[model samples]
Target chain A: MAGRKFFGHAEPREIVAFLTGGIFGSGLLVSGMIDTKKVQGWLDFFGAWDPTLAFVLGGAVLPMLFVWRIAEKRKVSVLGTPIPPRPAPKMDPALIAGSLMFGAGWGLAGLCPGPALASFAIGGWGGALFFLSMVSGMIVAPTVAGWLSSRTTS
Target chain B: MIPQDWIWGALGGLMIGGAAAIYLLVNGRIMGASGILGGLVDGTGRDSMVERLAFLFGTLAVPPLLVPLYHSVDTHITTNPGIIIAAGLLVGVGTRLANGCTSGHGVCGISRLAPRGLGSTALYLLGGAVTVFVFRHVLGVI
Candidate 1:
């Protein structure tokens, strides 16, 4: 309230967010990022690697770069919401370790969170299992961190 | 004729970026899927429940709708329950620990030229590439 401005009711903003998410989901579906074979293939650089994932990354990044540039000049969003804070640039252990673990998991399964969710429509029970397990992991992470910190302190 | 997958992949990427841009411009939020989900589950995002849920609802609902229109939403996920569970848990814990994932660090973070995003992206890619090499070439499990 003090630092940021809340425009109108959150309903409109929620609707907009939903619409944006729909587009994002559709894009992931269409781009083949949601497909495990394609994702695996892209990661298979030494084997029969497919370069499509790189293209998807490039394609997605190009436009957002412009948006970020515009964001730099503005204080509030187009809807008058306060601009979110930029994450600090520090490369702490958590960043590196978490990313490494995520990458290994991604390579092992050929599915990240986005594609994992998208796969729900088609991946059947396997998808459900992955989603459930991933959620469990997320729920447990903080506790794990706390435990680790306690162990280190003791 | 253009390769259908390439064309569609690029088109989809543009749409994803556009969606991210819209979320940023209109809602004043970063469209990181893991962050959104992680926060909601972890209780850190209580203040913005409506916003997060709305965005998630869109993401979850739209894909199923498109399944009828396009038969290309198929996924070739591994059938091994062990691998699937392991991967899921890793993604869950790893993303929360790292604070981002492909969408947050790979796409949105890189676009903003943030160091953490760049570093996370590079490390994950490296990690993925290495894992692939070991699994496919050495162990031949996948």
Candidate 2:
């Protein structure tokens, strides 16, 4: 079973990823991170503010710091695939602008992609609208960026 | 009763990090939601479709199962159709352009101390704060 493959590839890793996703979703649900009201409450600084999200961010980051360190020392992941390279460390305009836009969106809806999709089971029509529009935006992002680039250049 | 705010938040964060750690260590992939989903739809990540789908399947499947068990699964998402659509499109375009989102850049990227991740996180946080400020305070919209 150690070297066995499913569909000509390692199926166990896929299973692992699937299970990991389940854990991730359950974590979101259990932590109440999937709630738009909580998200908005955290962002509403000048109003009735909730500092809990800050703690959530902090909590999530602490362990991953160690994981990254361990990952760096190994060329291949535990499952035998090449580890992904560190992304180029630059503060380019695209990164800044894109993040800014996403943040605004997050602030507006109290939803990011993770919780948006995770909340779908209960989010109902509202979730469907957001999910559909989001996919549409993803599909058109390349073209929009291209258009913006051309306009700037010309 | 549900757990305290900070307690559950931190614990959840740990689970999120653990999931990400598992993904990285075992699959050698970053578990950013947008990047994973984007790759599947945008044709750039076709090579890893099976893995991505597996990951997504797990992500989407678990929450509903846990809904009854957890008293805190409430999302309270906005009911306004316009805002939802707008927010969704902005998130879609912005995250794709920026190359990551909360899970990817905010959580995974910042943890690794990557400049891109840090920069993106800061800008988004700033963006979120300002938007909230303007909308909630200035315009009185929420």
Candidate 3:
């Protein structure tokens, strides 16, 4: 099959991102990261003291390190988009607020976007709740962003 | 440590990875799950609001269709609905505020070697760890 070109410039970065995410998700799956029960067990903090979750993350980190190394060597990404200097957000209130909220949600639902997406594919109640809540969060963001933007503009 | 669970996890990863790749190829966008999700919410990039919603829903719901192959994985989310709702809102807000999520930063951001992405992912991971500690260990939420 002839490969048709898409995206103004298809670059290796895009390929890497796609593979990395898929691999991460696969890693989560193989490691039982998508299972909210296992996730919850890890989150339990008080009960069985399951720490297997960390290993899944640790395993992914190895491959991730390799991918980033390759990415850094190339000046222009396959997309032809010269990766701009990484912008660092000051460790500010917004970061704190967002992180807290995200952690709380994960602790509560035992799912985040990645694992939620994976679990949703496999039919689980936690995934369903996660999908719904995730939307709710998005719906509410614009008003907040607009308000914040206005403050910055003023 | 059931062997089958590991098999399912691996399958889930491949499906998600393939999906991200396809999206990148088609849209020329990173398959940052949060970004795609945030876009679906904001309705600014690529698709219109309705289309975005449909696309987002499809992206999310499509995974469950694989249940037959993986066998249904049982779950027990012990938290109340209110906590779940609140947590979701926070994540959405955080994704937009942070300009990404785990997929966006951990996967796409790192792939691009964006310093911001790396920083953001680190924040996310740290946040996740701390939150879990507080909720279960301190607050004692079962």
Candidate 4:
């Protein structure tokens, strides 16, 4: 794997990245984020309305709120690399259009990128089908987004 | 009353937040899943491709190993082929177009009080609810 050539071994950065991802994956599983029914039920707010997801959201957000502040105080990461500064929020057409598209899709399928990946074991071949299609969408999104950007700007 | 799901959900949520916090503090990057994957797939993240790949590897490889700890795991993804493809493509395009997903915009972006994150998350959640309503109530196809 090309990753092995990164500094000829696993650097702390790579290790942390791996750990971060692992922790995330574990969290997704334990938190039921990977459960399609749970997700769909949450989205079914107008229906039976499972309140499970809000807790997950709250759990993730509350801690992250503080993390961001701490990060803001540091010029560089512990690794001594500059943190990518947050971009100013802009509400644009592409965002609006894309958000609608994403939500519609999310509601239809009850899967998103992160859980889509994590749930492969549980979701099986059907999951693979969704993932491949998602990759296709992602590949083409830039061109579509670019078109949206141009239209909005001009 | 909080359901059992809530306890696990919050615990899991905390872990997710902790992961994001670690990534930001150590690697100095926001932990947006779609952005990470999109960057790699769309050829935008070539410089840090190794890191991206490693992070992705964790996301892809780790969860399956942990499933044995659970009593049972079910994703309940729709078996409908058409819905599967359309939803996948939409998520792919939507996240990329919007530059984030739940993790990016919902967790990371909202936490930082970034407008892009908040706005996108709101819209996507709305998107989900509206779609569910249409699919379940109106069209009855989803």
DockQ of each: 0.69, 0.71, 0.28, 0.85
In order of appearance, the predictions have TM-scores of 0.93, 0.93, 0.67, 0.96
Q: For model 1, what is the alpha-carbon lDDT of residue A90?
A: 97
Candidate 4, overall lDDT? 0.89
Which sections of candidate 2 miss by over 4 Å? Answer: A1-10, A151-154, B1-3
Categorize the docking of model 4: high
Candidate 2 global lDDT = 0.85
Q: Per-residue CA lDDT of candidate 3, range A1-154, in tens?
A: 1023223443444344434444444544556766666766666554665666555544444444554444446534455544334456455445545655665566666677766665565544545666787877777777776776676656
lDDT of model 2 at position A68: 93
lDDT of 1 by residue, B70-136 (tens): 7455688889999989989999999998888999999999999999999999999988889889988
Candidate number achieving the greatest TM-score relative to the actual structure: 4
How many collisions between residues are there in candidate 4?
0
Which prediction has the highest lDDT against the true structure?
4
Q: What would you estimate as the lDDT of candidate 1?
A: 0.86
Score each candidate by Cα lDDT: 0.86, 0.85, 0.57, 0.89
Best by DockQ: 4
Q: Write the per-residue lDDT of candidate 1 for residues A11-59, one digit (tens) a residue.
A: 7887798798899888889899988788889988899989898879988
Runs in model 4 lying further than 4 Å from the true structure:
A1-3, A6-8
